[model samples]
Target: MNIDEDTSAWLGCPTPLEMYKHQCAMLEDELTTAYQLLKKARANIAGLVQMNDLLATEKAAAESQLRSVSADLSRVHVQGSEMSKQIMSLKIIASQNEHLHIENQRLLLELSVLRGPRS
Candidate 1:
């Protein structure tokens, strides 16, 4: 139909051109908001990535420390075992010394008896 006829038919409604412009403005605002949100999301993602990298580095450091501690513990265990073995040897020697002391004391008593009563 004619433009005037279409305009007349719209009767109190906004004209098509005005409606289109308003819709375009609304769409532009929505696009701007979406772009801002996207930018914020990218920033958040970058921060998370950096945090993850830091955590990974910390984990590696902790693991290295754990390995070092494990090595130290292993050395301590070996030293403790050696100490235990030395203690056992010492105990055996002490027992032998006690027996030798008792035998020597008995021999001295026998020698005194063999000499008869003192003058």
Candidate 2:
């Protein structure tokens, strides 16, 4: 149909040209909002990546420190075990010394008895 007949058919309706322009403006506004959202999302993603990298570095350092501490604890345990062995040895030697001293005292008494009464 002719433009006038089509226009006349829809009484009080917006012209096709006006409707298209309105839809285009709405679409442009939506696109602008979407672009802004995308920029914000990208910035957030970048910040998250940097934080993740920092956390990973910190975790590695903590693990290294833990390993060092574990090694130190193992060394301390070994030293403690050695010290315990040495203490046991010392105890045994002290017991032997006590036994020898008693035996020597008994022998001295026997020697005096064998000599009889002194003038």
Best by TM-score: 1
* lDDT values, one for every candidate: 0.95, 0.95
| Candidate 2 residue-wise lDDT, 28-119, digit = tens | 99999999999999999999999999999999999999999999999999999999999999999999999999999999999999998899
Please list all clashing residue pairs in model 1, or write none if there are none. Answer: none
Error of 1 at 100 (Å): 4.2
Question: 18-51 in candidate 1: lDDT tens per residue?
Answer: 8999999999999999999999999999999999
Model 2 ranges off by over 4 Å: 1-11, 88-119
What number of backbone clashes does candidate 1 have, counting pairs of residues 3 or more apart or in separate chains? 0
Model 2, clash count? Answer: 0
Model 1 TM-score (2 dp): 0.66
What is the alpha-carbon lDDT for the whole of candidate 2?
0.95
